[model samples]
Target: MASTEAIAAAFRIDPQILEKWLEGKQPVLAKYASAHQQIFAQFEYIGGEWHPKLDRQSSVAMLDEPSQSQNAVESDRVQHPNSSEVDLEPQSTAMFQAVGIVTGAVHLDWETHKHSAIINGSTYPLFYISQKRKAFEALKAEVAATGNSRQRLIVYPRVIHFPNKQRAHEIAFQLVGFDKGQQTKQEVSRELLDFEFKLAGLWQFIPVCRIPCISIFRNFSSERLDYIKQAEPAKKVKFLKASHLPLLWKDAPCKPFRFNPKAEGDQGHPTFVTLKVKFLPERNVFSFVEQLTPVQETAPPFLKASKKDKASLRRQ
Candidate 1:
């Protein structure tokens, strides 16, 4: 079957129009004629609404609730809070925090066209898949121990990939809060700015520094490696000769994953390495003394100061 983009381009119409027709847009039949009707009907029968283009409001509503029961009977059914595209794994009540992965694919020029042509051709198409799996794995263990299935844990993963490097940097900074959080009255602001510039695209920057850690899952299957090798004309991709890759932690020491590279390559699909690296917020212990942090009081303002006292002060 021709890809959605290819089919849409052939019809000289927006892919969204084709999508609308597939979503029971009977009015489109009169506009496009019978041939297009057959095409749309086939799409509905095979693809169904599995690939339905949801509007912003519907998308937001779908994500608002976390503990919605999913109908497991239907294979192509939509689940609230956790769709096939984005999965919200169950986490512990104590560790019940929202985690988001801002993933971007840095593609080679020729491979870019190949991916655009094929629906699932991109290497990082399942970019958020592994991250979601890790979050679920961590949370499931905790939930199993405590027997707290009622607790809601939300994990949102967003994939962003564009050619512009500067825009990518902006996205990285925005996700990490390096741009916004660096605005405090301190001498270390310049150092933070420099760090943001260096680790823009290569590093996946997480917003919440304390709760969740950014983990990198790398698959070295022969097919994937071949795809990478063929995709890159310059041949910049390199394999680690060591069995285990080094793990670097923020504000902590480095610990490496143990594996013999030579032994792993004996198998059909060579090696697979996943590194879970934690990025903690760099805190200057001395700076806490320098800056007088604002105290957040939950009590009403008038409770601390009476209304009559305020009235007397206003009269004066």
Candidate 2:
């Protein structure tokens, strides 16, 4: 990601033209900017300056990792000719607010993804890695208690790149402004399913966070197969046996499950639990936020018990 000073030094272009080039929307030297995209990433224009699409971690590292001392970094800042002092610190992380729904939470160890929420119809992926887990827990509890899969959320979002996937920049949210009073609505349909299961309070390893956290997962294939085979016999469906839908608990005894990259198998038992899920495009995974009691299969109401069955029941 090219900085404003770097772009200026290399191109020697006017600030206004540079702003337009960063927009990448209207026609203004599109050929030149496109050709140079390899040299510069997609940038956003802010306060009449260029901001590169860099992840928060990388940006913070850039500020901290340099050998220069704080005084030296401060001295290197671009000084205004009229003013004696100029602070070189980059601007604060940009933020904006939106009313979104808490879709799902995703944590994948191999991908360096954790505490991330897929919100607003799965369009935004916001993550928080601070030591505080309360915000994330609050989100999970709200969804579970309300049973309304889509809870209206007031979110303050910022931009961040995937820590493992550097070139892929996306939106993130500051863990704040979770109002419990917000109304929620359930979006259950023929394709979606959900149900709950109690955790044994076991400890498990989460790869992304690099910590042993309490988490649990249940395979819903039996239920899924039953629904598919009975509801649509002609429709062909393939199951990815390795893809287990992990459950999110309201007041989970431990943190959510994390993927163990080195484990030979995903340790979990097969259960008849149904899950209400949403797909996270950023991580290419499904997150189950709400769970419901498994619906048992029953014979047709018109069917009557045979005399032999009644006799067997009497003997029992």
In terms of lDDT, the best-performing candidate is 2
For 1-316, candidate 2 gives per-residue lDDT tens digits of 2345656555555655555655765454665565356335544333333443334343223322233332212111111122111112223221111112333443312244334444433544444432223455676676677675453333333322222322333344434334433232322222232211122212333222222222221122233333333321111111110111222334433343344335565444212233333434445333445543332121111111223333343365
Return the TM-score for candidate 1, rounded to 2 decimals: 0.19
lDDT against the true structure, each candidate: 0.25, 0.33
TM-score leader: 2
lDDT (Cα, 0-100) at 130 in candidate 2: 26
Worst 10 residues of 2 by lDDT: 234-243
All candidates' TM-scores? 0.19, 0.23
Q: Give the TM-score of candidate 2.
A: 0.23
Q: Count residue pairs with overlapping backbones in model 2.
A: 12
Q: Write the per-residue lDDT of candidate 1 for residues 56-157, one digit (tens) a residue.
A: 222222222112243111111111111121122233121111122222222212222221111122232121121122333444455466664322222222
User: With candidate 1 superimposed using the best TM-score fit, by how many Å does residue 252's alpha carbon deviate from the native?
Assistant: 4.7
